[model samples]
Target: MRDYPLENRGAFPPHVAAGAGASISLAPVKGGFVIHLLGDAKSDEAALKKALAKIAPELGADVRKSAPNQWFWVGDADVSSDRLTEIQAGLPSQFALADQTHGRVRMRLSGPSSRTVLAKGTMVDLSADLFAIGQSAMTQIGHIGAMITRIEDDSFELIVLRSFAGSLWDELNHMAAEFR
Candidate 1:
């Protein structure tokens, strides 16, 4: 398996990395950065709560459960400035990111056709009744490791592991192109 190093285009559009089995686009969203909290037995909820409280006043963020098991304390992009430091300081343990070697990939999919495109590969009923705006989930359509999140009424973002990014993108692009 060949490896393609990620492009370092700080604060711009994501760098696209493509290889034999997968493709990834790491887009940087302004003002917000994802802090990967531990998901294993070592996860400390008390410390995470404390950290969230400390940053709440500074960033005015709203804490929401990301998936069935994951919690995310998100604020606007401005939260990146001071709130991140506050969260780090408040937590009893340091935040660690996911290992890149595991093929975890993220992308920002938005615009008018985002939802329509994702529907091609996803079976999880992307309709408004099931997956409404601001909702996120972890699931799989076929062999794809899907992290589907709704950005708006017409836009959605899909994150998958590097091994499946190309397949996911191709499916989405094919569906989305029809809308253009």
Candidate 2:
């Protein structure tokens, strides 16, 4: 993997994933962190709620549903790093941690053109009112695990696994090329 430091002054690396599909790298958002977790029918929602409620005051946790069985808790500026131990302590054993280093891929797309290109294949209504800033949802773009978020008025970010990264990138690039 090519290293692009946060301080680097250039466009992000074109293809960020090592596996088969197209991928782009999204710069880490300034203060927040994305913690991926998995829960089953047997999983404890009460514990999950208790954990989040405990940390909410400090981190400002917001739960965003990505898929039927997956979810992400976004912690705010003061809340993320400060309470890692407490957060982990609160989580059940089944929850898997997916942050930058361990995840298959992390890519961000934000621009006026983001939505236009995305609309070509995505069925989800990405209108501003429905998917406001910081709101995240997990749905399929074709067959991939497309976790899309409206980062700004015109920009959106999609995160998929490394194996499918290339295909996703190619799909978006092909769709966006016409716009250019």
What is the lDDT of every predicted structure here?
0.52, 0.59
User: Please, what are the lDDT tens digits per residue for candidate 1 over residues 1-180?
Assistant: 113433433322234443333322223333333444444455655555666666566553333344433554444443332434555556555443222322444556665555555666677788888888877777775567776777677656555655676666565544555554
Please identify model 1 stretches exceeding 4 Å from their true place: 1-32, 39-53, 56-68, 72-86, 92-105, 111-113, 162-167
How does each model score on TM-score?
0.55, 0.60
- Tens digit of lDDT per residue, candidate 2, span 77-120? 43333355566666667665454322334456655567767777
Give residue 26's error in model 1 in angstroms.
13
Best by lDDT: 2
Colliding pairs, model 1: 31-77
Q: Model 2: what TM-score?
A: 0.60
Worst 10 residues of 2 by lDDT: 1-10
| Backbone clashes, candidate 2 | 7
**Between which residue pairs do clashes occur in model 2?**
21-165, 21-166, 21-167, 22-165, 22-166, 22-167, 59-79
